[model samples]
Target: MGALLILAPFVPWGEFLSASIKNPGKYQRQKVVIDNKPEYKAAAGKVVNVNDLQTFPPNSNWVISYPSSGDSTLDAADADTFTKYELIRLPAELGGDMKDASAFVAFNKVCVHLWCSPNYNPAEGHKQYECPCHGSAYRLPDGLATAGPAAIQPPPTNAMPILILTADNDGALNIEPPVWEVNRNGVLGMGRALYQDGKVNVYKEAG
Candidate 1:
């Protein structure tokens, strides 16, 4: 039995292995649409104005949808997991102002550790993204893991996926379409790595 168990890995599972090897491209990495306009939509298909976000109490956050799937019937509140993001308005001490893109940040709600959803805690001196499932905590603004298991993980998995925001001439905030290759604007479920200069680096799968 021991020998059979040891040799099991060497044996191909017939058609499954053969089909996978025959069509290697069938499992290519997910492709995202990069040409989607940067528009922010709130629950019930309401268009969120960037200026309104600025007026929100400091440290407040709202769930928004980005990179529309072009389905007008789909409610923003019902957006797919990957398209949902938590938009945070920084506090005054964290460089939050009523204007400028720096006042806000958006992070993927999916926790990289175990795919549990994290929530924003606005308690004074405790503003952070906290995972209720495992107590993994991420610091505010940058989404860096500061406590719990996520903190001990290596790069790419140590940080939460963040979105890049830009302001239009009319003061509406838009989300720059995400590029999964380099983790720019961040890949939905995957975490991000940072360079020494604090810029997001290309994602490398963990070994």
Candidate 2:
């Protein structure tokens, strides 16, 4: 079989501050075996050999390199730690409220502003999207700034993947036929990418 890869663990891009890691840190790419399958975690910058691995209970919904194997026993270039934050995707159907498919534009699941991980919280009968740090909130119906420090509205095509599904008689949700995989990371990883990669259309002057 060929290699099936799970890319880096993404955090919301901007939740953590820029000055967090000033000095260039060491990155060690580590190979992790999942269910007897070999996988890899690339380090932030360069290669390192960590003799030990460390784990911390995850406060956020996504999982990161936790209590992994090869703790201080082995090292690789994958271990160079970088603060990579990305958004999480959740699927929901049109729910009969919309009349056309064009009602939404499925973005690559990457938030343009700061790449802070996006989360879904149903509030006031509308989806309330949130970033955990600094209290940035957006209206789910439209990625408009409801109340937060965001300079401008995040485009509707960024925070979500177009979803179509139907509920079975037993209440199990089923995606009809084809399913697509996306790397919202395609455009840029986060604010870091935006700044480094020169994607300027993202943050327009909020009038």
Candidate 3:
């Protein structure tokens, strides 16, 4: 029938929607153990020191993995792709500071459109997280989708899940343990709504 053909396009979203409704807690934010030995070249795992320019330079990004299991060593290598996040240090001109959390931002690399991984393109004037699978692009610093199919999607899926960062006394960056709540820290793949002036406005689905 014509209705069935029209609804075929939305079939893919049903799985995500059903999972979100039936098991909302699965998408809730939760504390994760950062791997002491992250992949990609950083062996010390302390390579995120904000004060150390040599460790984490401005406009640079790193792919880090966090263990989903409470045990750090047990799940370090087998950590899920959703647990992996891209940490980016903004340039000084973009509010990056030596000892400020605002200077850095981290987001889950899983693309909300189809769960494909996205990579940060640091090219000048093209500093955006772009997904090769579907051409979805998320803007830096905020992780909001600006292009491709993801931009037309609704909230939560339209944005990438962000990780809250903090700077220690030594200027080493740390991830604030996330709680199981939306908009507070950030949901796993669903993401949270963006707001201005540190104010968060929660989004609710209509019945």
Clashing pairs in 3: none
Per-candidate Cα lDDT values, in order, are: 0.59, 0.29, 0.63
Error of 3 at 175 (Å): 0.9
Best by lDDT: 3
Scored by lDDT, model 2 comes in at 0.29
| 87-195: candidate 1 lDDT, tens digit per residue | 7778778866567667877778787666678878888878888888668799867788898777766665678887677667776666654444224444445566665
lDDT of 3 by residue, 1-207 (tens): 433321212224344335445664454333323445555344234436667666666777776664345454554565476678877777767766556667888888777766778888888887888989768889867888899777777665577777677667776666665442345444555555665355645322211
RMSD of 3: 6.5
Q: Model 3 TM-score?
A: 0.70
Q: Could you arrange the candidates by TM-score from highest to lowest? A: 3, 1, 2
In model 3, state the lDDT of residue 185.
43
Clashes of 1: 0
Model 3 residue 178 CA deviation in Å:
1.1
lDDT of 2 by residue, 25-122 (tens): 22222222111112323322111112211210111112122123343223222332222211112223422122222222222223334444555454
Predicted structure with the largest TM-score when compared to the true one:
3
Worst 10 residues of 1 by lDDT: 4-13
